[model samples]
Target chain A: MYGGGGGHYDGGGGAANANSLFGGGGFMPSQSTAAPESSGGGSLSKVGPERADAAAAHREADHGRGAASDDKSNFAINSVEVSTIRLVGRMLGKVERVTDVAFILDDGTGKIDVNRWENESSDTKEMADVNDGNYVIVNGGLKGFQGKRHVVAYSVRRVTNFNDITHHFLHCIYVHLELTKSNSRLPSQINASTGIPGHANQVRLPNNQATTFSASGNTAGNDVSSLVMSVFHDPAIIDREDGITVAYIIDRLKLPEEVIKEVMQKHIDDGNIYNTIDDLHYRSAMNG
Target chain B: MDTSSPAAIVNGEILNKFVGRRVRTVVQVQRNEGGMVFGQSTDGHQLTIKSAMDIPVSHFMEVYGIAEHNQTIRAEVCTDFGPNFDAKAFDGLCKLANDKFKHLFL
Candidate 1:
């Protein structure tokens, strides 16, 4: 979901915690969940690198390094307290240069900086991408700057229109915030064997998203506003078959004393027990 | 008998020395039959020093004058502390041999 190289820190304790978590990103790297979604890893309990291409690309990107990638989709989605991505249904905003070489991308939720490096020889790999005002997908961690949070896109792909886009692995608890704004129809189904888009259908939530995620009834969405975690596109989940099952890991998080029993039993019974501060808020909203 | 123990060991090259309680005297340099983790040559990828024991430490080394710790080539006495070097610009110029950041002994 993000590389840990950039040093972004804010004054508050929460911000410091966030910065530290991302700083040590290489310590415990995660390969994108895209791989298994692409390959026909039909078994519900099993999830591994889905495709050889994805696995190879991911392995190379994360080679000998911890936590490096544009698509740290699975856990990062449920983790970041506040995050946003603009792949579609959004207008390109101002592209202000924060540093001599880098710029910050601002979508609705917040802005993310396009971090540059001293050792990196050229902006060639960076500037070759699409500019602001056009829709693009950014994959990186949220960083605190002068006063706002920004993303450092490891890679960017321009999006002309949402309708033309197909084959997305929307693996977050809540998938709506992916677009800066979207009037287009959301994806609803996944072909288990091919990992490709099957049909144009709409669910309360988008496909590839965990069932526990809900905009209205979500308990996790309460504590924070929009309560977004990390967001990125999974290159896997293309046309495939066998079967794909969504497993919930948040069910394992231990909640406060008051709600421990309900959470544990519900979790054991396959009831939703979200893992993050944002998740807690949304779940509470759903409950009330 | 193997007189190697009383000598200074670095990168597997044994520098046979006149043994002393605090310092050892340089005699002759001999390459090791065993490998260690540090070995390098100029203008090439770093050499891997394979050791049956511990991996090598520190990528850089320097020998310095005992007084100011300025790197100097002339050291009649030597210890694991090195020739006594400071972080001065003259830091790396003090090797009895090449100080090209390579293992002389591994």
Candidate 2:
């Protein structure tokens, strides 16, 4: 039954062969069950248990660094293992070499050198339009040689919209927080199933519901603005005559004070909320 | 060349935390006086930016350099963010980058 080259094994013959090999009594139960299936036969059912045992042994061996021993260089930042990174920054300087082109990038946070290999293809002109002071997005792998770190770029493209710069920084922060803090925030079922550490693809939020702010109509439901609004629109706080205090909102949200204040200001500007009783307290404008 | 220290994104309020360290901020240029630029931070605090070059007034400017004081920055690099820039959004980003999600950046 386990033979290659499409050779068919006769079921009754295979069962008799197994019984003779295993002395009959010990292998009888599985062979009897396998007899009904003419094509698979006793040998196929007999190998199933062995295959599972081998797989478990292989997994155990892999866990002990027998196979993945060379993965020690998978460096982590904020506990998230980084392989490829997307960065938005301004090109500070550039140099063309025989085999590759190197660029210095400053993304306000810090500076790093990006190296793009040159090949005998039309794509050699990839960095042709890029100039100093131009904002560009780089997709690359972070590499370290002789204790110095740099990026080996796969693709580099100029950023036309300034908002992308903002988005990139925010995205980096979001990803870092998600990977590091997800254990506390995510459900236990998700954590158990997604046991692989530092894999971003496995991280899933409990709710993907996009709550739109009535005032802007553009804000995503999962953003800070919507979160703040949800607290106000809660059944308990929605009908309070005096509205909610900033301290109360701060207590419930667990966000930074400056972040909540900024969100509140934005909501007020968008006409979603208004000051109630005093400047420190606020009520949802949509309540009335 | 000094990639060891990364600039922390800050607004008016978070500036105090990174004094004497490299930091970046976006502000609306209120006026340019001699070599110094007076601006309003995204969070509405007044800031004094010391730049060698003249920066245009009434435009949004992103300054990156060492934070000398709570409301001052010694500008190493300054970029114009154009006339119309979203201060509110930038302010929110500053708070998020510095306060809640600071580990990602610095």
* Every candidate's TM-score, chain A alone: 0.27, 0.41
Cα deviation in Å at residue A39, candidate 2?
Answer: 47
lDDT of 2 by residue, B60-95 (tens): 888888999999999988888777777887888888
Fnat of all models, as shown: 0.00, 0.43
- Which portions of model 1 show Cα errors greater than 4 Å? A1-126, A164-288, B1-106
When candidate 1 is compared with the true two-chain complex, its DockQ is 0.02
Predicted candidate 2 versus true structure: per-residue lDDT over A1-288, tens digit per residue? 001111111212222222111110000000000112211111110000010001000001111111112222232322223334455678877887788889887765456677888674433666775778887666555555554456676556666555556645544443333333422333443323321233224222211110121312332324567667667756567778788988998898788999999877655543345566776778764442
Per-residue lDDT over A11-64 for candidate 1, one digit per residue giving the tens place of the 0 to 100 score = 121122222112111101121133232223221110011100010001111111
Give TM-scores for every candidate, taking all chains together and pairing residue i with residue i.
Answer: 0.22, 0.52
Whole-model Cα lDDT per candidate?
0.23, 0.52
- DockQ values, each candidate: 0.02, 0.16
In model 2, how large is the Cα lDDT of residue A242? 80
Superposition error at A27 for model 1 (Å): 18
- The best candidate in terms of TM-score: 2
